[model samples]
Target: MKAPAISYWSLQLLLGWINFAMTAPMIYLYLGLPLVMRQQGWSGTAIGLFQLAGLPAVLKFVLAAPVDRWARDTAGYRRWSLVLLVGYAASLVALAGLDIGKTGFTTLFALAMLASLFGTWADAPVNALAIRCLPETERMRAGTIRSAASSLGAVFGGGAMLILHDRVGWSWPFFVLGVGLLLALVGLYLIRPVHLDTIATPKRSEVGVRQWVGYFASAQRRRWVVVLMLYFPFIGTAWVYLKPLLLDQGLPSGQVAVVAGLLGGVVGALGSLLGGYVTYRRGLHYALPGFAMLALVALAALSAALASHASLPLLTACTVLLALAMGASAGLVFGMMMYYTREGLTAVDYGLQSSLFVLTRTVVPMLAGLLLDHFGYLGMLSALMAGMLGIGYWSLRFVRGMGEMPPKMGRVA
Candidate 1:
């Protein structure tokens, strides 16, 4: 007898948990590390440069082909995820031992990069599994759920961990992260193995680099890719810098962790769920620009607050608004990306798309760091606001034309 169908809600909840687990390590590096480094009296340039530690994320696409190729018989994606998740968790434990003073920053960077790299390896199969499991009808909601889970992960990795680190030291957060990953591993064991035969598994030879690149050769695909690439840079960079901005603005470290990290994360998580609903009702094309415009407004308000050296009440209000808009935008964009991933080349296609997103998410923040040092907080805010406004306008024109292309444009053989 055939197995019973997994309920849509069950799949969402399971995948959401996995996504939350996957993102926690990233939060430690991206959100948690900057604060730690800054407190250690690291310069903006140094903290900004550490963003390169996420280089593995950008390069994960290059490794996707092998990940997709190997481990097919060993429950394929599940096998890969199992090994990598444990390894990543161990790396976090390793981090707990290191001292990240100016002298040991390189050691810390190397280990952090390794942990992130392992996380990326684990992520490749998870993305493939998500594509294989979700029916086209449920893809949008799946994206939203994944985004919400990611926000929660950020709260754990970025917010709560920061609080823990502030109250105690670095070791507690890292140990807790390892423990969390191991717990997630147990959850992964509970899910039924995905049947690869259900997907349109293209023969290995058919899905080549040339064909993969060719997927975006169409005019519409190119335009849509451009929108995905540009959308996150300005606002994303702002979010990356926002914590340090709060610290610089005279907020105590603990308060900054609560206001900018935890509270913002909670608001962002809720917004992601809401954004998913909006995307379901109005379609992602409508949701993208609408969310972008909201973010633009929030960034403008933030710029005004920065000008006045705003009090905690004003700063907290702006941070909350910005997080809400950003979380929603991220959810909508993630949902939009899911629609473009093809059946056979799910890992490669998703990896390529995600690499582009990570490219901007990683690179622009480095520039923002430089801008912060050279231009002061207000100047940096002004620059980001202008860029966000320009991109928001440009996105509406291009995103409207999305999904209008031939059905086969982004698919595998």
Candidate 2:
């Protein structure tokens, strides 16, 4: 018998908590740890090497294959999630037991790397379970919730954890996060197992490295991939360099952190939720082109501001516009990722697309940095603006070709 549908908001709440839990330790590793290390007078090289902890995220596609092969049903995915979440939480608790000041940097680094590995590996099954269980109608909202949860995680990991560390010490931050993860694990159990038609019987022969190549084999998927590649990176690059641009414009570092870091994150979260609502109301045909156009305008405005050496007020306005665009675009993009995921191969497909997404997101910033050095802010921003304009036009044409907005959920195009 088909399992009864789970409550939509309850599912989102559980998934959002998982997203938040997975995200926090990563934020701590990337943002919080560096600050503490720097304060401890760690060498620049050592601090730089700490970034290696995130390497596992780049290999998410590889990590996902095992889950796809082994976890053939919603129940199996849930089991994997439970086991992985346990490891993730335990890693944090283990880290809490060690003293950063006394523990060798190597030991601390290894533990953090282990935490990242578990977190990255765990995400695949959690998302696969989400994809399987969530009705097509709720997919966009799932994306919104995921995006918002990630932002809140950033605030907790990057901001609050740092404060906790200062007030109580390093151990407390990890201990607090560890306890939170355990609580999330308990909540995970409260969610009754759901079975969906989308969960296919395991076909061991079809599951392998070829699954990665098969993802892009469809013409419709290829067109969708084009949209995915083009959608977010330009605006993402701009956001990456926004802080330095503000500082160059004479904003104090503290003020810059408030405006760019704190304010930008909060605005991005609200924008994500609002974007999901807009997509729900207007549909993907409208939301896709609408967000692309908004992004184009925001990029143009930011470039013009930079070129003219605009005042802080004008710049701040542009910053808010760009952040909103970024957040909205992120929601739509994430939703589409879920949209494109193949039913039987949920984990591997999502992992492959996500790997591509991360690769471009990472590469663009480096290229943008080069542009910034050679052509300055105006040049870099203008270049991104031009890219967005082209991508935006292409997206409009592509959506027209799709024939309807938000293709019937879970029907393979």
Candidate 3:
């Protein structure tokens, strides 16, 4: 009945928010740019190709070994994250100067690609550090706080950027984002000084990729956890299908992007503040089940709204519901995943699961796009619904089963 106390909880939340704030530019810049270019007579396909540039994020697993091995002895992961923040912010400023209007589609896409690559480098250190710092029970609370931080960042970057750029001109988005990242770096520095020995004094055991792959393969009994990871992309892919649906319905692309960003990003961020509370009150067992219900109801409502020619109102409502489902799930599920990982395999387990999450987010969405091409939006939702229901059932069974497993490796990391 005792509450599990976390070390430096407030400081961790601050770091999480700042981390999210610092990293927002990576995706926000591209989210609005497509609509901006569309108005300037740029080909939509040309702008859409920008998605290809972020290929490095999913592949960060390959480079994660280097990140895991190479932090300065003095600062540990914090120093490394700071280094990435500096380089990433610098790339944002460079991106602003790239003559976005005059550059060929290929050239612009390349800059975006490089910027995202820098961001991939940044993301690895953050996640790795989080895995190392907090205990499993604390991860949900941390995730909730972190999700809120990132959600706020997304709102400012995605929602606020759309309106601001249109009225202020293109360069301002880059400028604002650069400043935001700089501030995040400052917040990061305030947490702890870079003292390598203090931060990374643990036993040195190199956990490599093959070992990581084997870990997952060995978790054969935990097959449903991996299955849940594979299913993660459907929701993301389903949402991606939403943008094109809105566009097809004759909504202004910028407005559509702005609305979705506000509802999904800002509202979702707000929703995540309750994530820790929800998990604490309802527990993870019910949290996953609840998200399944939310996703199904919201997606169906959104589908009906789309089919009926309802305007942005219906879209925004559906977006909020989906955002709620995502925020709660994001905060709880990831925390639960961390909870399930035993201490010895902490880094490798995270790396492998993260890779799976990213791979599906990328690949499933791409394949979903092809389906969108043939079946249109409605058919896409039909397919997504079927996949989600099946996966949700399997995931539910797994979560319940794990609760009954004999306690093993229950020590907090």
Candidate 4:
């Protein structure tokens, strides 16, 4: 029951806050923008199409080699994180100036995509830093901390911002977000250099995408990669569509933000923190499937509410449960991803896994919009529940096949 050495523990707290900041822009774009645009008479399809702006985040893996390569000689991940934070904050300020009501979709889309690009660049190094800093034993707890940070970010970005926009307008939320990012930038000064030799040291020669992929191509390694790619798509899609579904249920915008955005985010954050503690104590082999099953049960509860045309209050409760499930499951999966990431190439490998994770979260929502058009919210939820069951089944089976490895490999990458 020894705590992580003080140094590694401090690194975890620092990384956790950086993730909170990095998560804000995305939450604002996904949660806030959709609500604002929908209130402005934009169509469901248009709101969903805006998800394309998030494509840069998915493509961030393309930059992973460059980030890792560039950092080798300079200040390491710390430098990359600082540069991207400033750029992302500046982009958020610039975004504030756009009059979305008067602006063309192309222009707004481009700006959002640009902000996301900056955010994505900032995220790669944070992942690398975490992978480099934590020992195998600490990753689950770190994942939970990171997840809690993300949940708080969502509460601010998605919940608080939406309510602010409802009370104020478009520009102030962006201004606040820009200021938050700048404040998070100050935290960079707190991160001291970490030296963990236990992590694999990459030769200067083996630093490219080819080498990164070659490592993943081995028979034993490929299965882990597949697990990363497919694990969270269903729950992710559910999260994206939940806000809109609440709107359709006749919940006031402010109430929806309070229920789904603020209160739900708190529950989700707590769930993530709890998931991390449980995984750390009992091991991921026991925790992963348990979390996945809990997520499925939450989804079932949500689906039933949708089907029954439940009261707004009842729906609100279901939203909280679903958020809790999604947050916990995500924390567990993220911990597993971190555990599996190869040592020296942490950025590239983690980026690749995240790229696939973002791909599903981003793509499925557009399809959900289509389903909503044809079938309504109830139909859409039902379809998502079925997919969640199917995917959860396979993932649980995959968890069983994840045979033992060396201590480092057993952690996953």
- Model 4, 271-359: lDDT tens digits are 89888877666665667677777778888888888778899878878887888788888887787777666656677777887887777
Per-candidate clashes come to 0, 0, 4, 4
| lDDT-better candidate, 2 vs 4 | 2
- Which runs of model 3 end up more than 4 angstroms from their true locations? 1-7, 72-74, 105-107, 192-200, 220-228, 247-258, 306-316, 340-348, 404-413
lDDT of 2 by residue, 1-413 (tens): 44444566887888889898888888988888999999888889999898888888878888888888888788788889889999999999899898777878799789989999999888888888888877677787898889888877887888889989999987898888888788778877876654334445555546776778888788888998888887999998999899899999999988887788788888888888999888887777778888989998998998888878898889889989998999999888887788787766888888888888888888888999999999999889888988888888888887778764345532212
User: lDDT of candidate 4?
Assistant: 0.76
Q: Please report the TM-score between candidate 4 and the true structure.
A: 0.86
Question: Candidate 2's C-alpha lDDT?
Answer: 0.83
Model 4 residue 142 lDDT score: 80
Residue pairs in steric clash, candidate 2? none
- How far is 122's C-alpha from truth in model 1 (Å)? 1.2
Ranking by TM-score: 2, 4, 1, 3
Q: What's the candidate order when arranged by decreasing lDDT?
A: 2, 1, 4, 3
> Which whole-number lDDT from 0 to 100 does residue 38 have in model 4?
83
Highest TM-score, which number? 2
Q: Could you tell me which 10 consecutive residues in candidate 4 have the lowest summed lDDT?
A: 404-413
The residue-by-residue lDDT of candidate 3 on 326-369, one tens digit each, is 66656655555454443444444555566667777777777777
Q: Which ten residues in a row have the lowest lDDT in candidate 2?
A: 404-413
- Candidate 1 lDDT over residue span 255-320, tens digit each: 987887789888988988998887667765667778888888988999899888889999999999
Could you say which candidate leads in lDDT? 2
